[model samples]
Target: MDDLDLPTAAPATIEEFRDRLTEITDGLPRRLRQCADHIAANIDRIAVSTVAELAAGADVPPSAVMRFCQILGYSGFSEMQKLFREAYAPGFPDYSTRLKNLKDGGAGSPSALLAEFIEAGRLSLEALAKSADETALAQAVSVLAGADMVHVIGLRRAFPVATYLAYVFEKMSVPAMLHDGVGKLDRRHALRAGDAVLAITFAPYSEETIALAQDARDRGLPVVALTDRPTSPL
Candidate 1:
């Protein structure tokens, strides 16, 4: 929003665009920061959304949206939109269309749905295997194994993973605690010296888990995070 110089060339890919956005969004003025946060969180909508629609979502004026685009090294909103369109507009079916097709093909049946879920899980595990860092993983295992206690915290979609981890640790005779945060309870005070943290989260990460993990790290505990991607804020 300031009258700072900006580059003319747009980011060539969505990943670059996102990295740039993450790098610059916090330094922007209030209105432009609003635009950046909205755009980052709703990137898939940009290809089809109008300037007015995006502005409303950001709770800023259309002029502010245009200025935000310029700040991101685009000529304007249209140029930014073109970038997203080029990235996501090629033969990608929307979820509604996919669901409709599944229903029509009787793929909504229980067995078919189970098979779909199994295949999806397999693909996710395969990707995880391909991307895992053995050295970092080994370091994490060493930290957990050496710790007096391991504090596990994950909520929402990540809760099951945390619970299973706790169960596994218990069965293996490891000292571990799972922070479920039931009834708005705060269990962060239980974190003690000689403890380590295992934080599990994905996109739209659990704030409670992050806060607790940060608390542990601030107290000099080693934190080994399990997240979806490198850019994830764990």
Candidate 2:
């Protein structure tokens, strides 16, 4: 297998981390592959897993876990663990413990479920606001406005955002094209240099979207992507 070079920066989100991990699974050594499989299958446990503990669960040695972390551009297992913890677990009792608490709720009511959902949404929005880069958002809007035509490409988890962007652009009388890539048809031939592409994708990224984004860049299109991390192929 060829050596994989990970981005220098930590992944911006857990979904982006998974996308990169999926890319390397087929090329990993057998022990590392086991580690990958275990991590993917048991995301809920990853936040709390130690190098030794996770290695034991995956039936690999601690050294293999370290090697896996190094291949992903981390100093060691702990650095990578920190990113996952921040993304999904957020430093508290583990998810299973929380679920157990919910089941054993001593002071519960019908409205408690509603409160739980509302609180979850509030926390999610706060996290998003905290993580947002104002400069980046400004640059994105500027670039989109400057393009001759804006092409939006996203599939699976990102499709709704892509469609909404195209819809909004059309409403404003902007020249916009949404590439749903139905049946994986050939669409790159239609793109030109003056166009801008707004691509959105996360974990298990749509291969078709990545390929099209690459095509746009190769043809000199300015691609403004909304992705979980810099490593997103788009």
For lDDT, the strongest prediction is 1
Reference-based lDDT, residue 92, model 1:
41
lDDT of each: 0.81, 0.78
Instruction: Please report, as a residue range, the 10-residue window in candidate 1 with the lowest summed lDDT.
Output: 90-99
Task: Please write out the lDDT profile of model 1 over residues 1-234, one tens digit for every residue.
Answer: 344458556687766787678777767788988888788767767888899999999999999999988877888889989987776554244343445666778565799888865655665455356435677789999999999999988899999999999999999999999988899899888888999999999778888889988888799989989876444677
lDDT of 2 by residue, 122-203 (tens): 6656656755767779999999999998989989989999999899999999999999978978777778878898888987
lDDT of 1 at 168: 98
* Cα error of candidate 2 at position 152, Å: 0.5
Q: Give one clash count per candidate, in the order shown.
A: 0, 0
Per-prediction TM-score, please? 0.64, 0.61
Error of 2 at 182 (Å): 3.7
